[model samples]
Target: MKQGGDLLSLVGYQLQQANLRLETDARAVLADFDLTPAKLTALILIRDNPGCDQTTLGRALSINRSSAMKLVNILVEKRLIERQPGRDLRTNALVLLPEGQRQVDAMLAAVHRSDTRMTARLSREDIQTLHNLLTRLGPATGAAED
Candidate 1:
């Protein structure tokens, strides 16, 4: 029992350290693209879920509607994304432009490299174990099958 508690505490600390390192590394790569992590993430969301409305994006990103709108404004001004009127003509549907797609592809590649470097300390089996554990803890774990 004591050993299990010790292992849990140690794992918590390791996860915190890993999160901080990821934040630093992500910011460095995103800086090159003139984007913050939030912006890049919002772009990716737009790309993957075309026609998603602001409220939906806000929920997915865990950001408020205002923040989502602000990010959307930036992307629109940069010509990376555009908005279409939803069925009700009230909500705006997000769509990635060709430029947005290019940016997303580049960002994804950069993020992949960053992730590889961060996880390089782990063996392939260790990586798989970590992935499986995290998936179970994540929001979509059960929803994935639905």
Candidate 2:
């Protein structure tokens, strides 16, 4: 008996719509670098966690091992990352090459640009509050558990 047709009033619906819009904008922003958000995220993680192994990377990225391997393969092919023998002979540790580091710096700049554009309508205080709220929500909902 609830036929108000006010879908926008639902918080979950609004969140989903906003996420979709952000994804669209992000894809456009990252197109120039031939990267998706996941790829950029992986590169940044690999850069920050030097000598990290594929299993650790996949766990951090919330992806499966196969998917992680594929991502690493693409980055290696692009000459953005390299793999070296780990402490154990069976493990391969990932490292960002100099080119990868340079690209990651550019990627950070691009992310900042996107963030600025996305939050243009919000005041700095509002943005900070929103970030705080989202940080709380993610953990509470276990959406960020991975």
Q: Would you list the C-alpha lDDT of every candidate in the order shown?
A: 0.86, 0.89
- Residue-level lDDT of model 2, residues 29-122, one tens digit each, is 8899998989999999999899999999999999998999999999999999999999898899999999999988987798788888988999
Over 75-102, each residue of candidate 1 has an lDDT whose tens digit, in order, gives: 9998999999975778989999999999
TM-score of each: 0.85, 0.86
Model 2, runs deviating above 4 Å: 1-9, 140-146
lDDT of 1: 0.86
Distance (Å) between predicted and true CA of 35, model 2?
1.1
Candidate with the greatest lDDT versus the true structure: 2
Q: What is the lDDT of residue 25 in candidate 2?
A: 83
- The runs of at least 3 residues in candidate 1 whose Cα sits more than 4 Å from the true structure, single-residue gaps closed, are 1-13, 140-146
Model 2 TM-score relative to the real fold:
0.86
